[model samples]
Target: MKHQPHDAPPGDPDSALAGEAEGYLLARAHHDQARREAEDLCARMPWLTAAQAEDVARHYTRKRIDLTRQMLLSTVERASQLRQEYETRYAALRRDLLKLHAAGVCAALICLGGAGALASLLSR
Candidate 1:
């Protein structure tokens, strides 16, 4: 039910939360860098030279997008792994608690029985 970022790389919810992985931020930075690079190239490439500015821009943009997709996938997979681990640990703790509770109930019943028997013997 927890909401995650729609923009996050395919799998890295943890990286978005932790902000620790260089890989997770690569896509955003890459896109910015590509824009800057394309701008610089456009400024230098004279119109007289008839450079393919649009093609160059598209190529860099696509590369940045692809890298971002890769990062997203990695993040998502790690999050899923963490989720599974938590589930396993939670299940174990629940089992242990149930066992302890059962033991306590048994001990209480035994103590009550002993007390009742003692009282009956004293009455005789």
Candidate 2:
């Protein structure tokens, strides 16, 4: 019932790996482009001190890092939620299976006792 992310295909391992590789390439390209743009900014703005240009570049890098951090936190939260849901389902299934096993044992014992009584009556 869980939906696959836009990057990955569902149900096929090879396609999923390919999708992950594609996503990595795309992210790498984006980072490269951002770095190039930052360098160009520093090159074009000669009036700004070198330190100030570096600061500008750092600002962009920090923003990107912060965005990645937020995404990671969201993914962790989703994982925790899924873990809780699975635990709850497992507990319910275990309880039901236990009840079913007990019922079966009880039925077998009753049948055995009835057979024993019938055999005794036939012998008498």
**All candidates: TM-score:** 0.61, 0.58
Question: Candidate 2 — which pairs collide?
Answer: none
Candidate 2, residues 1-124, lDDT tens digits: the string is 3335666667777776676787688778767777777778778888879899999877876677568768977998999899999999999999999999999999999999999999999999
Where model 2 places Cα greater than 4 Å from the true spot, the runs are: 1-52
* Cα RMSD, each candidate: 8.8, 7.3
Evaluate all candidate structures by whole-model CA lDDT and list the values in order: 0.76, 0.81
Q: After superposition, how far is residue 66 of candidate 2 from its true place, in Å?
A: 1.1
Q: What is the C-alpha local distance difference test score of candidate 1?
A: 0.76
Model 1, span 22-120: residue lDDT tens: 545764687788788766876687672335777776776787677767887788889899999999999999999999999999999999999999999
